[model samples]
Target: MSATQTRTGSCLCEANKFTVKGDPMLFVVCHCMNCKKQTGTAFMSNVMFKEENVDITGCQDVGQYADSNNKSGSTILRHFCNKCGSTMFGKPDETRKTGVVYIPSVLIDGSDAWTPTKEVFAEKKCSFVKELVINSPQ
Candidate 1:
């Protein structure tokens, strides 16, 4: 959890990998329909960080899709590993303009240690899901 520590992560096939420098800027759980469909799960845990802090290797194996069916009415560029079809990260054009990247927590190794600071689209949360109580340091 050191401020300057670098964290490494890879896709299911290990064909695509990345290293993120420093701590994450934000950690959020999203219950949006888009997230559920994209991840094929109830919700998605997104760990956000400045793009400058992330270094991705195996760019050639990474593919992207333009998601235009989001609730926020913005097209999100979703990146994934072509080899294993593992979704890696997303870049909302607006957020990308500001140099921010939202990586799926499941794709980041050791991300379970990070607590969710916020939850989005709670109205769409599943009935069996329990809300998380987080105490953010900031």
Candidate 2:
């Protein structure tokens, strides 16, 4: 895809939609307990991008929670579709100043194209979940 390429996706109910531009900064698989609980899975995949590259429509249908129960110890603004309770993305407290946003890869259109560059909280990874091997973007 071109550097200016754009991707679009929406919540399960289509109550909230988003368009993101350019390639993602990082693609990560998180194994934190908070992530597992939030996604109802053993792990969660996230795609990171510069905050300015994303645009959301139907803001009124989105809900946010100040998540402070994670290992980070910082509050993360977790955005979800209020209508369907579909998790959308997370904006960490630092993101407000650094301008970075992480969205659930499952919520991205054509998500099959996503490749994980790294994994976080591996110590918390479930025993049955195999390790992910991916080429380093370095």
> How good is model 1 by TM-score?
0.91
Q: What TM-scores do the predictions have?
A: 0.91, 0.93
What is the number of backbone collisions in each predicted candidate, taken in the order shown? 0, 0
Candidate 2 residue pairs in backbone clash: none
Off by over 4 Å in 1: 94-96
Which regions in candidate 2 have their CA more than 4 angstroms from the true location? Answer: 94-96
Give the per-residue lDDT of model 2 (tens digit) for 66-85. Answer: 89987878888888888898
